[model samples]
Target: MRVMVFVKATEDSEKGFAPTPETMAMMQAMGKYNDELRNAGILLTADGLKPSSEGKRIAFDGPGRRVIDGPFAETRELVAGFWLWEVKDMDEAVAWVKRCPNPMPGPSEIEIRPLYEMADWQE
Candidate 1:
């Protein structure tokens, strides 16, 4: 099974500020965890995103579209980063997430969702 692990954004992440010592430590720990995942052959890809200020959004309605610039609202709903992993099942993914270091200096969240394969689309 394949899963996408989302690192949800926090207020600090949305601020796009410089990294502090605590954040640096967290990054180091995350690096080690990523290495473990890679060595175990479960990590397919992973990367952190820049703050939303540098991003854009395209909204679609019917046949119309609107371009919205970021620095979007709702910090908690923003995504800070992600990882794609191949695991035996959701349980394995949950186990790995449980072992991960804190992705933020303060309280944060990681969301795991399974990807739909072609087989799932067939009746």
Candidate 2:
């Protein structure tokens, strides 16, 4: 199974704050964890995203489209980064996530959702 792991954004992330010593340490820990995932052949790809201030959004409604500037509100709903991973099952993915280092300076969240295969759409 393949899963996408979402790293939820925090206020600091949305503000594009500089990294602190603790954040540096956390990065190191995350590196080690990523190494483990790579060694296990589970990690496909991963990367952090720039703050929403540097992004753009497109809204669609009934064949109409509008471009919205970034610096969007609702930091709690923003995504800071993500990981694409292949695992045997959701349980395995959950286990791997449990071993990951904290990706933020304070409270944060990681959401794992399975990807839909083409077969899923077949009758």
Candidate 3:
């Protein structure tokens, strides 16, 4: 099975604050862990995203009419990064997620969701 691990962003992340020394160390550890996954042939791709302020959001209600802006609110829980991984099952994915290091000094949240499979439509 394939899964995406979402690294939820905190206010600091959205504000472009760099990770602290401890956080950087944790990230390094996580990178090593990801390397382990790659060695085991599970990790596919992984990367962190820039601050949301660097992105834009577009809302389209109809053809040729749209509103575009950025630094959206209610984004406190948005994903700051993600990892694409291949695993055997949900349990395996969960185990891998549990091994991730916290990305922030405060509470850090990681959401794991299975990737959609074409076989799902065949049934």
Candidate 4:
């Protein structure tokens, strides 16, 4: 199964500042985990995004497009990073998540959603 894992943003992440030494250490730990996953052949891709302040958005309504600048509000809804993994099943993915170090300083969130390929789509 292929899944997309999203690491949600926090207030600190939205500030668009560099990570502290502790944060860097955590990131290094995360890198180790990523390496393990990659060595196990489960990790396909992973990336950490810059702060939301450097981002932009486009709202669409009936063919109308409105561009909005970033530093967007609602930190809870923003994504700070992501990982794409291919595992045997949800259980395996869950196991991997259980082993991951906390990605944020305080409480944070990671959401996992399976991706659908064309073969599974029905018209």
lDDT for each residue of candidate 4 in 1-123, tens digit (9 for 90 to 100): 899999999997777647789888998999999999999999999999999889899999998999999889889999999999999888898889989999888999988899996768877
lDDT tens string, model 2, 41-100? 999999999899999999999999999999999998999999999999999999999999
TM-score of 2: 0.94
Model 2 global lDDT (CA atoms, 0 to 1): 0.93
Top candidate, metric lDDT: 1
lDDT scores of the candidates, listed in order: 0.94, 0.93, 0.82, 0.91
How many residue-pair clashes does candidate 1 contain? Answer: 0
Off by over 4 Å in 2: none
Give per-residue lDDT, candidate 4, residue 36.
99
* Order by lDDT, highest first: 1, 2, 4, 3
- Which RMSD values do the candidates have, in order? 1.0, 1.1, 1.7, 1.4
Clashes within 3 Å, all models in order: 0, 0, 0, 0
Residues 3-121 of candidate 1: C-alpha lDDT, one tens digit per residue:
99999999888877577887788888999999999999999999999899999999999999999999999999999999999999999999999999988867999999999999899
Measured on C-alpha atoms, candidate 1 has an lDDT of 0.94
Candidate 4 TM-score over all chains jointly: 0.93
CA RMSD (A), model 2: 1.1
